[model samples]
Target: MTVRTTARWALLGALALVVTACGGTSGSGGAAAASERQVQVSATFAQGGGGPAYTYDTALVPAGATVEVTSAAADGGTTTTLRVSGLQPNRTYGAHAHTKPCTPAAGADAGPHYQFRPDPVSPSVDPAFANPQNEIWLDVTTDASGAGEATSTVPWTFPPDRRAASVVLHEKATATHAGHAGTAGARPACVTVGF
Candidate 1:
């Protein structure tokens, strides 16, 4: 993928547009003051299959476009919003809060969706523990300008010792049946976050 960063001004302008369009800001002050705790991460998808079986690359999220993930505290409620931007226009992408950080290390790659009570097995396909209520799932559909946002909320908060460390973008919507219910598709990019 063509991994790189756009100018800071571009980001500021985009953020301004995001706040206004989404009505996420209040008065002169904005989204910065509307939450309790939050984690935001930015990353660029690596071109080609880096790992995780498949990579969306240019075919889905587009190379080099910024991938952002924001996880916020429930704010005395059962809700955590996850947002993404700088993606391919008019396409849907599935994303989840991961148990590990995004890395190229052979053994430390984003490991599984962060489950409230981890499924005893890997690649958890079980509907009971892999459902949206047990894990954070943000499936986003971008606009004409390759910017979008999605939110996910659960009744519980991340365990202090082991919280979601990353957010991985995928090629498809989260499934709802016999297959991996939370598995979006081949992970294309991940945003390393701390929550």
Candidate 2:
């Protein structure tokens, strides 16, 4: 592996350790509840086939790339953090929480963005339903080293009846225009994250 790749893995490992360390249950009032509100996952992109984390476009996402997701619900809201490495350098990737797990066939398998309030119409372009406040948007811009991170905090938590199951990375940054709000380009990669 290249030096950059090695360093990225090391960083991911450290982040995993930090998340684990902070996830311990205290067995006291509200302490265990607090720990239960957090979720963290780290996975390497599957190369030859589909897996928990898969790269649909090898040219952009590449094999062996790593994705780390951290979601925490507290203070009457939910905050999600997404970190990615070993992707194409100097590019912005649009990512959002999806309604289903990823599959080998197509990015569509991951389903639509997990909206706190379901949009009445399909392909929701209306800002009222597609805005960041209604859905988790994590658009990350990679640097020269092909590493990037993004965080999104929404005012509401994922309801028990419906929760996000994956994170889909798109080809470009998300569009916020009136007619194209929440529209990102083709999906290049996906990571199945339980949140």
Most TM-score-accurate candidate: 2
Model 2: residues with Cα > 4 Å off, grouped in runs: 1-28, 31-36, 48-50
lDDT of 1: 0.70
Tens digits of per-residue lDDT for model 2, 1-195? 699999999999999888766654333545747544888989998754658898888998998999999999986799999999999999999999999998877788999999999999988888889989999999999999999999999999877879999999999999998878899999989988889
Candidate 2, residue 133: the lDDT equals 95
User: Looking at model 2, which ten-residue stretch has the lowest summed lDDT?
Assistant: 23-32
* Tens-digit per-residue lDDT, 137-179, candidate 1: 8888889888888888887777668787777788878897866
What's the number of clashes in each of the models?
1, 0
